[model samples]
Target: MKQTNLEMTHNHLKSIVMAIAMIICIQNANAQFANSFGKQKSGKQHPVRVYFMAYDMQYPGIAIGPEYDFLYATHQKIQCNKGTRYTDKHLYFVPQFGIVKTDVQSVAAFVNIELDFKTIYQSGFIVDLFASAGYAQIFENQPADLGASSFENSLFASHGAFFPQFGIGTGYDFRREFNTPIQVNFRVLSASVDMKEFIKPGLNLGITYNL
Candidate 1:
């Protein structure tokens, strides 16, 4: 059998990438909300929106430890659309990070992109789909049981030669207008790293504010 170079250790690079992902997802949800909500508020050169979409994760084999999250968690986005008087149909860039706060403090990083299309003005909602692909670096404390050994590269990457990760998700964004900045976004996203590794599904709650 070939020796697997892959080891289970904390990945700092993945942490940063995940943070960027969190931010982009949150912003994508918020922008759709703000654009379709109420009046576009006067005197504002740009409009920003915020939203919260419940979050969850799955990583069974690595370590089935206790799952904890910050009760007050959210993602943010900044929109600059130069279309509707330099208003709607704008472009955005988002990056995010998350901390698993409890007895143990663990962190992750992410970054992604967003685009808007189509608007429905009937049930106080915005109909647009978003797909974001990024990487996440995580850390594991040395317990010796789960095989945590010290090595040069504790972090694994998707953009590298070994394996790659591509996550895709979309759902309905509900909000009245662009100023109120409150929305309920539903997303079912999946990502796979290795052949034996399972595809992880994530649901994130995003919150944004116009800058």
Candidate 2:
């Protein structure tokens, strides 16, 4: 009986030891995996993400046949991101579709880039300036519903041309830059063909994710 009791105690202690060893091994493996992933992230650029922007602005200067121009319009855009946080620069090709109240078909595209003016590693709010150039084509498609259901018409602005774009924005991180995945930002963009004729100006209030 004494021998059996001793054997049981020894076995229990050995089992506890083995269990502790296994746990340690698992923890080590997890740490290594996380470290490797971090390295991979650092080496690559723009991990490839999809972003969407929903914006609303007043659509001014629309000719409604018998000399009527109005305001107040809403627009939407969906974009693919080729943006890198480390570089503090991003490029997006956005396809935008909008309606000018009741008679105009508003379609345009833009490619913009955000550049960080300050160091990305710095804490607090970082104000950045951005510039982008693209084409804005206004088209008039035959009518069915929703602003005449336009495809691409000559009455619209040139569908393809180089335009000048300029904007200013600020970026805020909740925690530190490297540790956070979600960021919030606000920016205003104006695309212009000449110095005076503006294609469009939009304000974007959106979120960004870092993978």
Tens-place lDDT per residue, model 1, 34-77, is: 45542232324233333322223542211011101111112223
- The number of the candidate with the highest lDDT is 2
Task: Name the runs in model 2 displaced over 4 angstroms.
Answer: 1-56, 59-104, 112-118, 141-158, 175-178, 193-196, 199-201
Worst 10 residues of 2 by lDDT: 63-72
**After aligning candidate 1 to the native by TM-score, how far in Å is the CA of 169 from where it should be?**
7.1
lDDT of each: 0.34, 0.38
> Over all chains combined, what TM-score does candidate 1 have?
0.41
* Per-model TM-score on C-alpha atoms: 0.41, 0.43
lDDT of 1 at 29: 52
Error of 1 at 7 (Å): 12
